[model samples]
Target: MIAIETTGLEYTYTDGTNALSGVNFEAKEGEKVAVLGPNGSGKTTLFYHFNGLIKPTRGEVRVFGESISKNNIDKIRKRVGIVFQEPDSQLFAPTVYEDIAFGPKNLRLGSMEIKNRVTQVLHRFEIEALAQKNPSNLSGGQKKRAAIAGVVAMEPDILVLDEPTSGMDACGITGTMEILDELNDEGKTIIISTHDCDLAASWADRIYILNKGRVFKSGIPKHIFADEKLIAEAGLKQPVIVQTYREFRARGISRGEVPLSVLDFMDSVDVKVMNIRCAIAGCDVEAGDEVCLEIKNGMLIANKGSNGVTGRAVFDGKKGEDIAVRDVAGDILQHEGTITIIRVPGIIEGGSRAADLDRVRDILSKNKHQKMGAMGTSAKVLMTRLGLVCDFEFDVIQSGILAALRGFDVTILASGGMADRVAEKVKEKKLKYSCFVL
Candidate 1:
C-alpha cells in the first residue's frame, strides 16, 4: 500500500512566495526515505500538506489511500506523526508525561489507553526519567527525544520528521537513527527532511532533492549522492567521504568506487589517502612541502583538535541593554517568537560556518514573526537548537553572509579573522559595542 502520496502538490504563502510547485512524490509502505534539501526548499511545506495542516494551492495529497481534506484531517492526523525540526515547537505542557499524553487524550482515547501509550513510548525512547520534568527545562537533545516520544506514542503508521537530527550531538544522531531503524523494521514508513548529508547517506534507503518549489532529483541514495549537478542545485555539499574520494581521484589515483561513509572509505582503502598532498613528487610529505610521494596505507596520525576560534557573544537588545552570552559553544540556546519577516545580507548560505549558524538560530528563536531570516545548513543546525524557522535558499548562499548579516538587530557572526574585520568596521562607524574576545 502507498503510505503517503502526492500528485502535483503545490503551496504558496499569503505573500505569494512559492513554497512548493507541482511536487509529485510517494512513499511505499515500510520504506525509509530521506527528503534531503536546503531550508525553505518546500520540505516542511510539503509535509504540512500530508496531514492537512495546510491545503495545497493545487493538486492533492493522500495518506493511506485517503485524500487530505478538511473532512479527513482529523483521521489523517492520527496516522501521520510529525516530529518538528525544533523540539520546542512540539512541546507545550510543562511535564514530559503530560506532553506525551496530550495527543492521545486529544484523540479521545480512554484514560487507561492514554497512559499505556505514553508510558510505552517514553520507555522506548528511554526518557522515562524525564517524565515529570518540565519540557522547557530539558536540554536540547533531551527535549528532542521527548518530542519524538510524544509523536511515536500516537502509533502513527507514517512518521514524518523535519530535520530530525538537527541540534543533536554525534551520539544523539546515532541513537535516533537506531530507533528509527528499528521502527522502520517494524513496518513504519519514515520520511525525514534534512540537510545532514551524512545521516541521509547512512540511514535513508532513497533520496529526494527539492529546490525552488520543484523536484530536482529522486532515486536511490547511491545515484542521488553521485549526481554532482543535482547536489549543487540543491545547495548541499557532497559528503566528506565523497569529497575525500574526489581528492584522491584528482591525483591520478584509481579509487575504483567512492564510498559514502568513513567506514566504507576505510574498508576500500587499498591505496594511500592524503588530505592535502604535496605539489612535487618522490617523498610523501605534508601539504606545502617542497616534495611528496604516495604509499599504500599512508596516513597522518594527527589528534583531533578544536578550531581554536572562540569569543564572547554579546547581543544588544531593542532598547540598548546588552545580553551577554553566559556559555560559549556546546551550550544549548533557545528563543521564542513569531517572526514578521526577514531581510538578510546573504551570508546565511552554504559557506556559513556551523558555529556561525548556531548563533543566528539562537537569536531568531526568541523573536515573534512569520517571515524570518533564512539560513543555510550551518544556520539550520543552530536554529534547531533555538527552535526557529529558517530557509535554505540557494540565493542566500550566492548572496554572501555579509549581506545576510545586514538587517538583524543582533547578528551572531563568528569571531577570529572575521570578527577582527567586523571590529574594525565597528570602530570606523563608531558604533557602541561590547563583546567577549576569545
Candidate 2:
C-alpha cells in the first residue's frame, strides 16, 4: 500500500516564492525513502505536504489513499509524524519528558498511557538520562533525539525526518540512523531528507533527487549513484564507496557491480582475485615455484621467481585451460570466518526470553576469538543489560562481513527484520563462510 503520495505538488510561499512545482512522489508501506538535494531544493517543502503541515497550492497530497482536508487533517497528522531539520523549531516543552508526552496528551490518551509511551520512547532512544533535563540545555544531538522521541510517542505509521543527522557527530549519526532502521523494521514507513550522499546510498532503499523545486530523478540507490552524468547534473558528489569503486575500476584493480559499502568493496576485491588467470601460453609453474605476479596497466604479469616479483598468486590448472590464479596481490583468505546471528525479542519482551539469552551466552563462550556485534535497538539494549561488550554497534552486518574476511569469526545480535538483513548481506558476499542464526 502507498503510505504517502503527492500528485503535481506545488507550494508557494506568502512572498510568492515557489518552493515546489509539479512534483509527484510516493512512498510504499514499510519502505525507507530518501530525498536528496542541494540547498534551496524542494526537499523540505515536499516533506511538509506529507502530513498536511503545508497544503499544496495547485496539487493534492494523500496519506494512505485519502486526500488531506481539514476534516481529516488531524487524523492525517496522527498517522504521519514529521521531525524537522531544526529541533528547536519542534521542541517547546520545558523538560524532555514533557516534550515527548505532549503529543500523546493531545491524543486524549489516559495520563498513565501517555506516561508509558514517553517512558518507552525515552529508553528506546537511549535518552532516559535526559528525561528531566531541559530541552533548551540539551546538546544538538540530544535535542534532535528528543524531538524525534516526541513525534514517535504519538505512534505514527509514517515518519518523515528532515536532515535527521545534520548536526550529529559520527557516533551520533550512526546511532540515530540505527534507531530509524529499527523503527522501519517495526513496519513504519521512513522518509528522510538528507544531504549526505553516503548515508542515502547506504541506508535508503529508494532515492528521489529533488532539484529546482522538482524531482530530477528517482530510483534505487545503486542506479541513482551509478549515473555519473546524473550526479554531476544534480550537483552532488558520488558517495565515498562509489567513488572508491570507480577509482578501482579505472585502475583495472576491481570489477563487477558498484559497491555501496566497505563490505561490498571487499567482496569485489575477492571476485577480482578469483577471476584472474595466467595469460602467458605454456607458462607452467609447479607448486611452491616462488613465482611473482604484478598488475601493470590493468594486466597481470607473472615472473619465474620472487626476486623481483611484487606479489604471489596461487595457481590451479584445469584440463585444456590456462592456470587460474586465485590470490594475485594479497594473502589468500583460506579460512573464512563464520558469522553467527542471534535474534532477540523486542526490549519489552526480552526479559521473558531467558532461554534465548542463555543460548546467546553459551554461543559467545564457545567462540573465544569471535568478534561481537549488535544490530537494532532491541538487541543492543538486551546486550547492554547482559553486560556484553559489542565490538561493532553501528553497521553491524558490514562490520561482521569485514571481520569474517579477515579470518575472525563473528557473532551478531539482531532482532526482527535485521536478522534477515544480515543473512541477505552475507549471502551477497558468496564467500565460504558459515552463518548460523539462533
Candidate 3:
C-alpha cells in the first residue's frame, strides 16, 4: 500500500502564503524516505496533509490509498502520526506520561491498552525514567524525545518527523537516528523532513528535494546529488562525497558507479587506471629478499626484484597511521632478508550511514589513533582526520596511483569490488596478472 501519497497538492494559508504548490509526493509501505528542503519550502505543510491536520487547497492527500477528508480524519490520524519539529508545539502536558497518553486517549482505547501503549513508547524511547517528570522542564533533547514518544504511542502505521535532529547536540542526534532506525526495522513506514543535506545523503534510502513549495527533484541519493543544477535550484549543496565524485569525473576518472556516502565513495572510485597487477593471497618466499607482506587490505604482491624498503604499507588515510609499514619496514631495515605480514582494517560500506560511521571510527580506533577530528556527520569525519586537500585523495587507490605516477613500480592490487572483476577479465583476455588470494 502507498503509506502516504499527495497528488497535485496545494495549500494556501489565510495570510495568502502558498505553502504547497502542485506537489506530488509518495511513500510505499515500510519505506524510509526523506523530504529535504531549505526553510519555508512546504515540507511542514505537506506533512500536515498526510494526517488530515490540514485540508488540501487543490488536490488530495491519501493514506493507504484512501483519500483524507472529514469523514475519515480520525482514521487517517490514527494511521499517520506526525511529530512536529518543535517539541514545545506538540508536547502539552504536565508530565511525559500524560503527554504520551494524550493520543491513545483520543483514540478511546481501553484503559489497559492505553497504559500498555504508554509503557511501550516510554521503554522504546528509553525515557521510562522521565515518565513522571515534567516534559516542559526537561532538556531540549529530552523534550524532543518525549514529543516523539507521544506520536509513537498512537501506534500509527506511518511515522512522520519534521527536522527530528534540529536543535540537538551530537549525542542527541545519534540517539534519535538510532531510534528511527529501530522503528523502521520493525516495519513502520518512516518519513522525515529536514534541511540537512549531509544527513539526507547518508541516512535516506530515497530523497525528495523541495524548492519554492514544490518538489524540485526526487530520486536516489546518488542521482539526486549528481545533478548539480537541481541541487542548486533546490537550495542544497551536493554531498561532499558527490562533490568529490564530480571532481574525479571532471578529471576523466570513471568509477562506473556513483556513490552515496563517503564509505561508498571509498569503495567504488575508479582505481583501475593505476594498472597494477591483481591482488593474490599468498606468495612463495624468495631467496635473498626481505618480503614485508601487507595483508591489511587483503592485497598480496609477488616480489621479484623491487627491494626498496621491502616492507608492506597500510595507511587508512583518515588516521594518518603508517605504523604497520613503519614497524615491518624498521625490522626489514635491520635485517635485509626477513618477511612480515600485518592486517589493517579500514572504512567499509555497510547498509546504513550510521553503520558506516561506526565502521570508520572502529577502523580509526583499531589503528590506535583515537584522537580524530569531529567524527560525526559529513565527509570531515573521515576527510578531516585524513588531512586531505583537493590535490590529495584519502583512499588507498589514489595514493597508489600517485605512487605509480611518481615512478614507484606497483607490483599488485587486490579488492572485493571492481578490482576483483577486472582481474578476472584480465585473466580471460590472456593478460598475465596476479590472481585471487584465497
The prediction achieving the highest lDDT against the true structure is 2
Candidate 2: worst 10 consecutive residues by lDDT?
316-325
**Candidate 1, poorest ten consecutive residues by summed lDDT:** 331-340
Please identify model 3 stretches exceeding 4 Å from their true place: 248-254, 271-438
**What ranges in model 2 sit over 4 Å off?**
270-331, 348-356, 367-369, 431-438
Candidate 1 per-residue lDDT over residues 208-252, each given as its tens digit? 888888988898877877777778867998887787877866765
> How accurate locally, in lDDT, is each candidate?
0.62, 0.80, 0.63
For model 3, what is the error of residue 31's alpha carbon versus the real structure, in angstroms, after optimal superposition? 1.3
| Candidate 1 regions with alpha-carbon error over 4 angstroms | 252-254, 271-438
lDDT of 3 by residue, 1-438 (tens): 888899999999999999999999999998889999888999998988888888899998888999987798888888889999889999888999999999999999999999988987786576889999988899998998899889988878899999898887776676577567556655789999987787888778899988889888898887887678888877787777777877877776647566665545644555444222222223433233334432332233333234533443332221221222322332111211111111111112221222334444444444422111211122222343345232222233333332332323222222123244334433432322332221
lDDT of 1 at 206: 84
Please report the TM-score between candidate 2 and the true structure.
0.85
lDDT (Cα) of model 1: 0.62
In angstroms, how far off is 176's CA in candidate 3? 2.1
Q: What is the lDDT of residue 424 in candidate 1?
A: 49
> Which residue pairs does candidate 3 place in steric collision?
279-413, 281-437, 296-344
